[model samples]
Target: MGTREIGLPQRVPGTGLPARVTIWEVGPRDGLQNEKAIVPVAVKLEFLDRLAEAGLTTLEATSFVSPKWVPQLADAEELLAGLNKREGVRYPVLVPNERGLKRALEAGCPDIAIFGSATETFAQRNLNSGLEKQFEMFEPVLAGANGLNVRAYLSMCFGDPWEGPVPAEQVVRVGKRLLELGCTQLSLGDTIGVATVGQVEGLLAAFADAGVPADKLAVHFHDTYGQALANTVAALRCGVSTVDSSAGGLGGCPYAESATGNLATEDLLWTLEGLGIEHGVDLDALVKTSAWMAEQLGRPSPSRVVRALAG
Candidate 1:
């Protein structure tokens, strides 16, 4: 069966929320990176095209990490080469370090992201550098960016698997450094989905106190503990309009075993639509694209909206 048409939720017109939110669609790069089998480059390109067609303006296309680390995205260059690259949409790729940045520059990348960790252990595991050295590594990449749109992802902000709860000040302190490195946006990551509403608020408040405005911050939450939406609402109420999510709930951290699927784009869109916030995503089209991806992956989509509407 093809994707089933879904009904739109009634608008409630939530108060104290931004009029519009930018959904940083990470399904292509982050979602597909978690798969066990290598998705064909053609399929990856098609997936990106479908996402753009679904009205996602910022679709993360691919990561420039070494194939030895993430073989799933080994076809990153190929996928980018074949991408249709819609005009109004931004296709950002992950650049791990100088090498990845070089590759991105060679490919004429218009946008890129650098991933960092909130704790020392995760930094060592994910980037092969200590917390202090992580910034050292990102320096050259940021310098090379040369005014292209760049995003910095600060993972494990709410909680860490090995390090436990991360202090709000610590996240703000480190995140500020990334911003100082010339990253236009900093995405606070709840890598293991352990963040509660209070944690979200406190961290945002801390960022504000640290002179980092909400406009420069984005929230990336995992749904492992089923609090992704709740936390997102908390962040939104705190004046953060940028949210990072994976389509069809299809992403997890390869370096962190406790991490599960990312906040689903379909689910987030439903919440925004009901709240009367403009996210600019076509929910039905997004659900259909996710449903199609589920078939390609040989599994049912984990997104509640996808299962309820399109399954």
Candidate 2:
């Protein structure tokens, strides 16, 4: 079949896609947090600057978690302080709990993100708590994010390495609770990248049934199983407009042994362009940024778009 037959919008004269997709770039925080080698603060700042120059409006800057856990982001405060803070660009930092939130506030962070897991094992492994205890932990943090733009991430929504397929109902319940706790947005995560188009559709259907508007949700997919782009298409068709991706396909869950790099922002942008989607990102600039970041990491980018553009 053709692209038109699949119901995706075609490009119009002097205009982009019918829908304007928001690409939430997570390379700075989620992408680099797992690296064993520490990246210099100057290099990190340069990377952030490059992304901004590429027209990425929303970027995950850094995590205010304990230095002992994620030493890579230990310079969170310094990074935030040194950032150019471009106008019209949002830099959201990840805060694990009230303590992290306090640190973020002290650092003058205007936006924060909290992470929750949908399944028991992942909850314990990532947050070091049972399901209910995890929510208890988030209560104070959410309560503290009064004047900030808060985003909640629900990981392992599709499938868990420890426990196979997760039920869509469970994800909806957790997502609803997060929204009730005052999270302005919820990003459903396929942490292991095992989600299929059917699973994405089913999960969105469940969210709709639970009164969670598509506007209130974003999708985070890893490219581990090579299904991230397909799942993203499924999500867009279901009315989801925001997506989380890492430049150069950087990032892997430190807790999930089977997890791989996130969906590449450049690849996602390519797909968006093909669908005539209106995202203000500069694809060539994004590719150049990813290629430079790969050099900093002493390797080539895993992103297909970067490779193709580089060639």
Candidate 3:
């Protein structure tokens, strides 16, 4: 939304990767929310179209949270209503509570992701309730979603903004609770982007030790410290496949200071290619789409790969 800032591109860490990796694009909801200017629904639709054309199958379209909380996505209903659902591509909305869930369901979002913070402070700040109380809030929504066969996602599994370096045990504990609460997939979010490879390993190891299956976890990292892709490699090495990212390297939590975009989809795809990991995405297409969205938003991309390529 301003003048461009040129930067160096960083190579992803780790070794020969898997054949394919799934990219869960969150740009529509997460990316736009951080912009000072409200993005038009037409622009949002165009952005989503480009992403789907680039071979992205899963996307977080919008959040059903109160407009008072996230004015950027206040048009959540209209946005969802206008989306031209592409076959095989799953568009999920972030339903914050029962009310939000109702709106998403009414808007006909077949898939949804319910958010619950791992730390009490974040839960209170974001959800207006304590950790235990947040679960209570999710109970009915989870039950309703389970009945309707909707998906759920939990956030802040790595580190919290209010609380420093969340304990590995706590991560496992919260993860299990969400899994038990009927979350189809649990995304371990590095909310403040303070996670390291070793920390990711330990966190996943703790989950493994807790008898939670590896197939149920997703890794969501922010590139605030330029370590998201590195941490993602670590998770992949640990056999965790599902990764949450945003195109053009967009998004950061409002509550988290200095937090940057979620891991760039372009950067992630490049890493997957280097590792022999398979992701159904087209790297060149992703770069083009990223540039288009950045142009629409009137801002330069936060993605290192995009910057390097454009430069």
Off by over 4 Å in 2: 1-18, 254-259
Cα lDDT tens digits for candidate 2, 1-311: 00111222254422322378999999999999978899999999999999999999999999998999899999998999899999999999999999999998898888899999999999998899976789999989888887898999999999988899999998999889999999999999999888999999999999998899999999999988789999998898888999999998998865455666799998898888777788999887788888888889988888887877774
Can you rank all candidates by TM-score, best first? 1, 2, 3
Q: lDDT: which candidate is best?
A: 1
Least accurate 10 contiguous residues by lDDT in model 3? 1-10
- Model 3 TM-score (2 dp): 0.92
Q: Report the CA-based lDDT of candidate 1 relative to the real structure.
A: 0.91
Question: What are the Cα lDDT values of the candidates?
Answer: 0.91, 0.88, 0.81
Q: Of 2 and 3, which scores higher on lDDT?
A: 2
In terms of TM-score, which candidate is strongest?
A: 1
| Comparison by TM-score, 2 against 3, better one | 2
lDDT of 2 at 37: 98
Q: How close is candidate 1 to the true structure, as a TM-score?
A: 0.98
For residue 218, give model 1's deviation from the true position in Å. 0.3
